[model samples]
Target: MPGEYGYPNLNDNDWIWGGTLTDIETTLTHGIRWEGSDATRVNYMPAFDGMFDAGQVAALTSHVLSLSGKAKPNATGAVLFTENCAACHGATGAGLPAMGAPALNDAIWLYGGSEAAVRKQILAPRHGVMPGWKDRLDPATIKMLAAYVHSRGGGQQAAPAAEPATDVAQAPMAETDG
Candidate 1:
């Protein structure tokens, strides 16, 4: 809402990933689609323009909207969803954390959640990317930021103590500059 690629508010319980401190910490260390870290997370929802016809996409949008009870469930959409979306969004539309799919049943949307918006997303999905903070902040600082995020009340239980941020090893230097 803040910008073209702005992230959602942190205070909400709707986490793309899980809400655990470790989970948030992991996300912070290696952002979504971030190329900076070896452990960086990435999930891509391919556009459906080539995959489905316009009518199918509209029907799929109808089904997705129906997951939240916003629209009547059309057989066409439901069938498409069952065959396609259910794997990641789940049979009940409860999104999978591992797959980075947001729950469609929930009204909370990172992007606009209108029917048209849904259809557009089906046609050309948005692969939201979150930048990693490892290069910008030290491990301890990252943990502190995590703690602050935890204080926002959406945070889950903390995981066991683990090392932070410095997952990748330095690349070997090549003798080039003379």
Candidate 2:
């Protein structure tokens, strides 16, 4: 259920952008890489066609497959993964939600999970686009849609807000001795 055609399968818990209500609403409003909207959720994985040779591409592909335990791990692939793919996809291929990178360590994949499919993607990355409903649909409709999607079993809670940093220099003096 992870891969639905070329797009991500919503039936599962793996969320590329996010599964929270707010996150879902934002995606529904702006869309993913939709050119029609300025606020589209955009993240592009660069094609390694010209960047690396065929051997290197194969190594990278092998590495990706190995992440999900689909193939045997290779030293060449590990080195390539560390040097090239670790920034966004993460060192362990766990993925970074803020960067819109999917977890490669898991069996889930946006596209097909075959070795050939992985190789093709690494060679010439395929980017999917979702249309924004702000221009066509009313705000109420969008909100309702978001709610519906959030009700699905895969929905996730929003991340907690970061704690505010304390200003050590602004500490108040204690009056206990007075």
How do all models score by TM-score? 0.83, 0.85
Best-performing candidate as measured by TM-score: 2
Pairs that collide, model 2: none
Put down candidate 1 lDDT per residue, 36-69, tens digits, no spaces: 8889887687776888887888889888898888
**How far does residue 22 in candidate 1 sit from its true spot (Å)?**
0.3
Instruction: Report the backbone clash tally of model 1.
Output: 0
- TM-score computed on alpha carbons, candidate 1: 0.83
Best by lDDT: 2
**Candidate 1, which ten residues in sequence have the lowest lDDT sum?**
169-178
lDDT of candidate 2 over 1-178, digit per residue (tens): 3456778877778878878888899999999999989989888998878888888888888888988898899889888887777666767787756667788888787788898999888888899889999999999999999988777668998758722212211221211100
- For model 1, what is the alpha-carbon lDDT of residue 108? 78
- What lDDT is obtained when candidate 1 is compared to the true structure? 0.74
Off by over 4 Å in 2: 1-3, 161-178
Candidate 1 positional error at 113, Å:
1.0
